[model samples]
Target: MASAFQAKGLQYWVSELAQAVLPILPGSAVEIRRLLEHPDTSLNQIGDLVAQDPVLRLHVLRACNNQFAEKAAGTLSNPHHCVSMLGMDNISALVDSLKPDCGANNRFEPRYLQAIIQSSHAAELALSWLPFRHQGNADQLVLACLLYGVPDWAMWRVASNEARMIDALVQQQRVPVEEAELAVLGCQRAELAKALAQHWHFSDQVCGAIHGAPIPSPAFLMRYARLAQKHSNDAASVRMPNKTEAGLLAHSQGFTVHLSNTLAQQSARSWYSKPTLRCQAIVAAYLDQPLVRILELTKSVALETSRRFAIVGVQSPAEGLLWPQPSAQRRRIKPSQMDAAVTKMASMLGQGSVPAKAPKSATPAPPSQRPDPLNQPRAIGIKSEKLPDGLDHHAIRSAPKPAAKPAAVFPGFVSAEKYADYETLINKLLHQPSAFSSEQEALRSITDCLYRCTELERVVVAVLNPERSKLEAYYAQGCSEAPALQRFTVQLQPPNLFTQLLRQPAATWISRERQQQIEGVIPGQFRQASQCEDFFLMSVFNQQGAYGLFYADRGLTDRIGLSEAEYKIFKSTGAHCSKYLMALQP
Candidate 1:
């Protein structure tokens, strides 16, 4: 099946590989397995343990949900309920299943081994350091760190050659790992990992960690752990760049960095069971040692770990590890040598240095005969003739002036009197007994008011289903008889902007600038069907939670700009609708 998918291409094979390896636990999962061995462990205790790690919780819930689909009344909200439903025997079996077969050593490749080692080191660091700063379960942090490199392992399993090529490109070009992966595989590894997590029903927090944008706490810890591991294992000094490279440097100075480094130092100290030369070297690197010294220290630490661990029936720490090294044959190809070779090549080709700057002439030639300045090659180190004193040369040959920007024509703002009138109208609508008779009627009245008062080309009201898991279009106005709004039924799960808005009830003005920023969060189908550039998202809620949302938008070419007054009015309208909705409820 894996080979068949691989033949189809990266998209198919990567997903298949992710699914194949979903149940394969990292080396750190051994610790969790050890805890599950005791018979006295309660469901709550096991739940807590599983919940700490997103992957573990996901595995448990997925198994439980699949096994009890018909019997279960609702979706299992947490690990405790899932474990309770599955029972200890089933839970034990699930844990045992996650353990890699001891007999299957031949299946583990060098890349897989390396990823395991990296994950173990990161998990150790997280377990050691994450607890001191926060009261949350430390085990979850450990699990998150352990699974941080899952994408790398999955990629290697599916496309080893492509994975190696990506690594090489990242090193050679000094580009980001994700960017290099995108160049080679046509998709970011992190995005693939997130997709897999989502597919397997991982918790939102865990999925977000895999995504790594807007870095959540767990993801942040994993990043630091990876950085420390890289520094310790690599022979070359991991030089911290002077300036923060956008999208590259995850941490500058914060609690997360400080805690990660502290944990890293602690993990290093535990390596030898006593404070030794290697331990000091690791600590010094964490303390921000000079780059040259860090290189030396890291090499010593790697050598020590390899020598000590290899003696204890463990694999050599640095065995088969690829580390960037300083070139030893420094004088083999100098800049001078390259220049000399280039000069000899040019001489042999009978080409002289750039034709002697167009021979200077006393008088200017006719425009037609003279070379076009735009077309002519610019001469190096040659200065143009100076203009006569006070004769502005820049102004004489300046480029054409840019066109003026058109004034905003959209009716987004309202005068003080007009705003007062809008407020009065909203109040009147809210107090009207006939309007509040039914939820549908209230929604219709609200949509009608927006259509009449605002410059919106379309307006829609989508009501949450009874399960609160899906939203369906209940009302729409303007644009056409068969409104495009009907196509936008949104699922509350696998959260998008609509779901997020429901979670935090608010009125959002989706300006053109913001629309681009949040394109990923907005439903692609809705974006395509509506073909609207900017829109207003107003979430309606009662004490029970967000029951519906009102969407208003202009056409694709037009912009929707709302002032503070207009925005407040939109909010009040939504609020009034919410009040009427609650009143209609039994």
Candidate 2:
């Protein structure tokens, strides 16, 4: 079965796969299917069992919806409703059509298991969000989300070899799954899924979403509005002309399912990955909530989905969240490098008693109380010869400094050619003056230039609040995944770098050398927010004087240094933007 469709087109595979018997169900679903052979099996009892397994529920819904297309257009009810709609004989027939072999050795592949779990999570999220969107067929959308990855699961089972190769390529080489799928299977999974769903007569809601049909539920409408507003400040609400209320309702419902499925699919990757973050941001915008709230909702849904679909030997997104292992950058120290205290502690524990209190000479006097590090008073005596850790301070100070390594480029580093291009674009915009029609456009343009033309990983424009008591992030580039950077704010109650910038239109560069000098006046909150000590700051002023601040920096772990050239461009960009703002000021 796996080899039959090799080197074939999408339509060929769809037509062949749709008619082929489905692979054996997951272990849990297979057990539930076995109960169907019992002569005393009741429809209600079978429905309850089927509802417990996401895969089994999908099979039942697929069968029922295919048989009753009209009824499926609206919200299809629970498993019991689908079971009653399809008599016991039809249910048994559906199970029989599945590949017959089922054994205790049957184990789900990682890709297949992840797809199932992710789809389940997506379905749960759709259902959870259903209450917020009253215009859609809630049940239908949830079903669509649940069955969204049906094609992926089916392909993995029927084409194990190809799927394995694709998975290995994606994981080991970091190649995109779509690219691997195209190379190995001769077509992308999405196109294949759409064709297969259509061939199998799946519900139109699921099929349309896979086919990329636009359904404008409230969430989708909100997503559209957010994107529109992101590009233009005065973006108005999007309206569809000549469409009746019913049509709009149907569109919205379809889009809701589409977006839910999209978001879930991306969840199989790191939650902080670019695709996932973008989807989360869209969801956050739609819900009119913070990104943190959206993250919490998704995590909660993943856990609930894991509980509802308890598949053994399979790790779900919930597990990833609950017990995240350390990253490569945070690997545990090797045992051989254990400190003296750690080694002593281990030896004492092995003896089951504190190794008979140290000898009198070694114990010396009672242990001195350590000063409160955060509030320790400065010593007024001559410098100590030995450090607190008992190291000779003079020897350590005299040791030759380690040779400095060349700075490694940050992940967001722009190439020299790209920087030149950005610089050219900025220069044109500044010289032409008519290139930007609004003050907002000019500000966004400069923010973008700083991000692309310099080594900065993030560039933010924070505007003063109406009361002029604080500065809040108004626009940012390269900050979507960083909630802290997105929420950049600084209070002006006390004198600080930001307050000084606002006092007069001036630019300040907090290089490594300057950080120590301004450390006292630099706001602690800004340091916590930006997570970078060295950054560029300049006041943005119009005819009304300083009203905002321009901030830019390499990211949290940036190894690169801010060059003088980059700082010059940063300041010049701000100057041009300020000039534009003053011209536009009424």
Candidate 3:
């Protein structure tokens, strides 16, 4: 049987290659993501991983100590220093690209090793023939020609037979791969390589190198091929100026060069992994597990690719120069790099743990079993302490005691004369500033709401925190004391808390923290305390959606012990505020 590596077809082969190589790369993506559940995994552990890989460790240091980060003024000598300066995610991404799994080794079989080497040599020659600026892509073109014969093995082909055909074309026929494929197998190796390259997720450039017209200048090919073949005898420190020369043939066709027999022999002896016919070593380990679990492992790699490739951009103004200075950092990778990611993501669904046509119900348990407690936290103490009769779990946190009668403000302020204007002010803040649009308008609107609303005195309005999934203070007028605002800010989900309650249309729903927050409200929007507050969450909402205002007080005004009619008005007013608040969109 041919080795697993000799198989053709892009998706299947890439997936196989990826499975083979990902374990060698370390840091299975699943393991990386599981960190979301464990916040304590520090930068130290990650630094150690980088230190283990000589190439990656050096790159990490270079990037961190680069000109862009020079001003950060941190002395980072190693992976530990890397994590502290660059952050975990950033460091992980840098090391990820260096993995062997990233289409680093293109050729699958050792049978045509000589032909592959010679073809790669020819590609180098073609690159050298180009102008100085176009030399950079030589590595890409060389790898392209090396694997040019791959597409032909797409169907099942016996390994010994495949090896004989490759040898006949190269050692016997003494021809290049493109001719070798056609003369011996009746098709061009370039065509087969192109098909396989496309199948495996190779970039357009690589495919073009294998199949595109040969480089225009024979002299260039002669130079590049000679130098590339000499690469073995030359010092390891030497690197060709591929970037310089390849620039001239940016979009044009390039040709191949032949690797000397000696270099081909040396490379095969030093670099090749012994072929494993069945891939039984790794596949056997995986066979016992559910397919879903296997896919889970692969999905992590796909997710990593997406995150690495995701570019963040700032708007470049049209009125300015045609192209802005490349302020935005750009990291380029070939199209082939994505082939493995695509196949893994697509096929991973099939390998998932559960079948699509699962049984309707789980099989019954045996004679003895305990209920699963994963969903609920197990409390050690008295179950009786759960809650007393009327109060919900929200009230589990204690609310501030209402202030003394004279200090209380809501009772005197909520009177009919003052109520109408207060209602009008809140209604105005309920939406965007066209009728009221700017940030300044938002502030002004809130100021009016606090000024006119009676003893509910001071109120503060805050925006939702995008990163933290919570509300943050935007504007606050009548709030008093850091502790009061602090209590309100905790556990307040910007849209969710109110949306969930309002959907039920409960006439009076205490906030989940209502038990912990009542005395925090002060009359006429206390201005002194709201400034220091970190998370400013006001329960001020209009009828539409967002007028979420929380009134804080030191003492209970007569309004706290309101008439049923007055209480109903407060509730209805809150609903109205909700409607208006929801109208305010970013």
Candidate lDDT (C-alpha), each = 0.53, 0.64, 0.38
Worst 10 residues of 3 by lDDT: 272-281
Candidate 1 residues 1-586, lDDT tens each?
Answer: 1111111334664566656543343443765676677667677887777765544665677687567655655444456778898988887887777744322453335455445444444444434333222414443344344445566666656555555545433322234454555555667755666666556554555555445534224344344334544565554433223223344433322222223323333332233222223333333333444334533544454555445323222334453233212111112223333334323323422333236567688889888897777887654222555445675666656746678987544344334444455556567455433213234445766787776666555788887877889878876777574355654678867889888889856888887678668878988767766666666788888656787898876655554354554566577778777775554322
Candidate 2 on 213-273: residue-level lDDT in tens? Answer: 6554555545544553353333232332323344653335555566677777666545545
Number of the candidate with higher TM-score, 1 or 3? 1
Compared with the true structure, what per-residue lDDT tens digits does model 3 show for residues 37-109?
3679777766665544322443555466553343554333445665677887775665454443322233233
* Cα RMSD, model 1: 30.2
Per-prediction TM-score to the true structure, in the order listed: 0.33, 0.46, 0.22
Name the 10 consecutive residues with the lowest summed lDDT in model 1: 323-332
Ranking by TM-score: 2, 1, 3
Q: Which stretches of candidate 3 lie over 4 Å from their true place?
A: 1-133, 136-158, 173-179, 214-253, 256-586
Please give the lDDT score for candidate 2.
0.64
- Model 2 spans > 4 angstroms off: 1-7, 20-41, 65-78, 96-110, 215-251, 322-586
Q: Any idea how many clashes model 2 has? A: 4
